[model samples]
Each structure stands twice: as C-alpha cells, then as structure tokens.
Target: MSDAEVWTFNVDDYAAKLQCPTLIIHGERSDGFEAAAQHVFRKVPAQNKKLIIVDGVFHTRFYDDPLVIEPTATEVAKWFKDNVK
Candidate 1:
C-alpha cells in the first residue's frame, strides 16, 4: 500500500462520516493539502459546505501568511462563528 492508498482508506471510512456543515480552507500555493482538501469535500456530505482557496498563499500560510495573516484568521473565525453549532 502507498501513502495515497492509506489516505484514501482513512478518508473513505472516517472523514466521510462527518455529519455536519463543513468549511475547507486551502492556499493556492499549497501542494500537500490542495488535493486532500478537495477530495474530502467531495466525499463528505454536508448541509452547508464551503471551500475557500486563498490566493497567493502557500501550504504554511494558515500559520504564517505573507501579505496578511489576519485576513485569513478573520475568515476562519467568521466561518466558524457562522457555521459551527
């Protein structure tokens, strides 16, 4: 089995079982999470689903964005405040 296979199994069994609204945020410059996040979003069935791809950001931008980390932080905060129960 390869990394892809292992991740596929986990996503299929566990990630797919989430039963609530979901918000997926990714960076345009990210490589690691770009595909995984999309795959999870496609597999998981949610009432309200949102996929936010921040332009000009890398994989680590979530932690330390260049232009403005505060904007990303604010977006996530707002999303959770509005969506999560």
Candidate 2:
C-alpha cells in the first residue's frame, strides 16, 4: 500500500490518549472532514479541549481571507493564551 494509505488507520485510540489541551477548528461551510473532526473531539480525553466552528466560511478560506482569518486568529490566540499557560 502507499504511504498515505498505510497511514489511514483509526486514530480514535490515539486521540483518547491525548493529555494536553487541544483546540479543534472547523468551518461551518466546510465540505471537508468537519463531521470527522467532531467525532474525534468527542473521543478526546483532554479536559481542556475546545471546538470552534467558524460561521460563513468554507474550508481553506481561513488561510487567505482576512474576514475569516482575523476572527480565527483571535480565537486561536485566545485559546493558546488561556490553555498553554
């Protein structure tokens, strides 16, 4: 099998082992793995985990659009500040 195919194993077991704070960000309009992201979020054992779904944005917009990136950046910065220390 290809390397990517070989890596396509179940990660729920690995996610359950996470002990550090985790922040999961998804786009509300994303046609990607948003549902899978939610599924993993439910399985994560971290007490300091957070999930944020940005409204009115699609996947990949967060990297280029200022309207999307601004708020997303704010949320990420706040999350790091609140959780990392």
Candidate 3:
C-alpha cells in the first residue's frame, strides 16, 4: 500500500469491527492522531480496550527515544498481559 492509500484509510470505519481486545497507544504530542485515536477508542466494541498517551513524546519518538520507549513498552506489555487470553 502506498502512503496515499494509508492516508485515505479511515480507521474509524473498522473500529466497530474491532471485537477483540484492543490496545490504542499514541504519544501525547501526536496532534494529528490523538483525536482520531480517541475516536477509534470510543468506537471500538471490544469489552477490553484502552488508550495510552505517553507524556512529552511525539509520534515518532514513540518508536525511537529510549526514555519514551521504556515506559511505553511497559504499558504495551501490561496491556497485552491484561488483555491477551
């Protein structure tokens, strides 16, 4: 898929179909995705769902910075630990 295709993909359209446990993690400074992430979170039908916003981190930092990655990884692990069955 191309970047254009990814840009066109409306995750909200598939949010209701997320019947399984879902973990929505984003950076606090992800101005572009934060609202959309929250929207998807609200739309998801999963009984077990969560949204985590890592402090002082931007979208890309969530993938790179060690300070940001550690706690975020912990959160991801905890989410999987609590949700994956």
Candidate 4:
C-alpha cells in the first residue's frame, strides 16, 4: 500500500485510545478535511473534545487571516483554560 494509506491504517483504533482532551480546529472552507476531522472526532474516546470550524476561509487561511485566527485563538484559549487548568 502507499505511504498515505499505511499512515491512516487503524487510525480509528488510535483515536479511540486517546485519553486527553482534544481540540480539532478546521476551516469551514476546508471541505476536504472537514469529513476527516468529523470522523476522528467521532472516533476519539475523550469526553473533553471540541471541534471548531472557522468560517469564510480555507485551511491555510488559519495561519494568516485575522478573522479566522482571532476566533480560532479564542477557542483554543478557552479550551486550554477549561481543560489544561
């Protein structure tokens, strides 16, 4: 099998074994990754899990766009405060 296929093999099993809190950040415009994120979210065993999809931008925009980054950072900070503390 290809490396990508090999890398994803048994991914659900790994996700199921996760015990810590997880925050999944996705861009609403990143349609390609949205389903994959949802799949992993469903598979993860952690009760303290969150999925935040920032609106109006694609994947890479999360790195530079203020509109996306601001909300994403807010969510991340909230997650950290709620879970890490």
- Please name the candidate that would achieve the greatest TM-score relative to the true structure: 3
lDDT score of model 3?
Answer: 0.85
Off by over 4 Å in 1: 1-9, 66-68
Which parts of model 2 are misplaced by more than 4 Å?
1-9
lDDT (CA) for every model shown?
0.77, 0.88, 0.85, 0.84
Query: Model 4 lDDT vs. the true structure?
Result: 0.84
Q: What TM-score does each of the candidates earn?
A: 0.72, 0.83, 0.88, 0.78
Count steric clashes of candidate 4. 0
Off by over 4 Å in 4: 1-11
Model 3 residue pairs with clashes: none
Model 1 residue 64 lDDT score? 64
> 38 in model 3: Cα distance from truth in Å?
0.9
How high is the lDDT of residue 14 in model 4? 80
TM-score of 1: 0.72
Ranking by lDDT: 2, 3, 4, 1
lDDT of each residue in 1-85, candidate 3, tens digit only: 8999998988888998999988888887887778877888999998888888776778999777898888888888988888797
Which digits, one per residue and each the tens of the lDDT, describe model 4 over residues 1-85?
Answer: 8999897798678899988988888887886888887898899988889887766679998888888788888888988998996
Error of 2 at 80 (Å): 0.8
User: For model 2, how does the per-residue alpha-carbon lDDT over 1-85 read when each residue is reduced to its tens digit?
Assistant: 6889669967798789998999989987898677888999999999999989887779899889998899899999999998998
